[model samples]
Target: MSSNSPFPSLLDGTLSLPVTPLIRGALEHSKKITSPTTVNHCIRSAYFAILLSQKLARKDAEPLDAELIVYSVIMHDLGWAVDKSLLSKDKRFEVDSANMARTYLQSTKESGVWDKHRVQLAWDAIALHATPSFSQHKEPEVMLASMGILADFQGHFIANQLITVDEFKAIVGAFPRLGFKDQFIGIMCGLCAYKPETTYDNFVGEWGCEFGLDGKGTGKEEYAKNRLASTFPRTLLPTLIALAEYENEAPAE
Candidate 1:
């Protein structure tokens, strides 16, 4: 990957992918469960995170483990897998994904390579990848991983000038988006329909607010419109929807 490194990257020249065996395994597992869109997003997140980290130029920062970033981010959305079994009924999608990544690291054939600390680090990166307020302040690995993911979703808002437009195009060129927004929203909506409780606190909850299968209002749009009309005074729309749903669901006297 680097000038002095012996590990040959699957990518060559410029920004490269240090293709380790574990990374390969992680990619295969991701492909088996989730759609190719997610798989590309995960891989892109690693490159974006690494490049952004380098741009940050933290003096005396510990060298980032690229394999760890790739392996961890690659499976960050295993909870969104088409396999269904990985999608838990009770836990948030992030939590489910984190647990799966942890298990993979623990079960790898490379003994002594992934100690408990490393495994936990991977868990933190995937689990907290969506929680910028907290993850942005945690370890470099955690923050970088989260930022990388946020960049992929939010783009310039999160990356600022760190990742230039050309750089972004190159990354997206290598890994085509393929209607990521629609696909991602569809999956979250499915989550809301299947396990609304798990989406109650996150952005997923917003899409969940729309799906009628949750037994909320007459329908999603009317319910959301009603909530928008009333709850505008108290809280944010997504938070309001989640709170209203929970309040309505409680057993009444």
Candidate 2:
């Protein structure tokens, strides 16, 4: 790479990463809004996603969009901002984050650089990044974002193989974990404390229930024991029963 080249080549120059003014701006914007831990987490997730994208591209013979992946990852946690004033009272954090990303990306819509489709992709990627079972089935960009986030938290299974152990170490060295487990859980608990209803359907609800849901230093260890969520072994029966009446009254197709 020339001295004038703006793009970054990481992992000992083996991987070339795209860095546009928008990408740089987004990263700066992320640092400005969220906690340092969350910012580092997003950066780490972006690298993981890009690495995973490269491996998946080689396997499927389809190249993934690195810039879009970075864009999606960097802003994926805007909903976890420490300042409650920046968040909505009722929307899930994932939705809140997705909306923020969409609004930011939309500014470039008229320029045709960030067109409707690309913006939508970024939105979907951010919104679904927490839902692996679902996101993995979506578009490549969406799946990569989710996979990358999971990789950071769970140590990508391919760490030693497709992504070298040394490379992973480099990523960690550049963007330290910063006690992510406790810090991330604390952020989620804060959300649950503020908006329990918004988290009722997601994985975070369990976290809320297991940890301190009241947000007043109280752990609701037994809170979910007798609740329908835990006692009921059956899954869709409640939903099916709720809609069964409507189905019985409808005309046959």
Which candidate ranks first by TM-score, i.e. highest? 2
Candidate 1 shows a clash count of 0
lDDT string for model 1 (37-60, tens) is 988888888778877777885788
lDDT of each residue in 124-189, candidate 2, tens digit only:
999999998889898888989998888888764544556667877888887889999888778777
Q: Per-residue error at 175 for model 2, in Å?
A: 0.8
lDDT of each: 0.76, 0.78
| Residue pairs in clash, model 1 | none
Runs in model 1 deviating more than 4 A are: 1-12, 110-112, 210-253
Whole-model lDDT for model 2 versus the true structure?
Answer: 0.78
User: Could you say which candidate leads in lDDT?
Assistant: 2
What does candidate 1 score in Cα RMSD to the true structure? Answer: 7.5
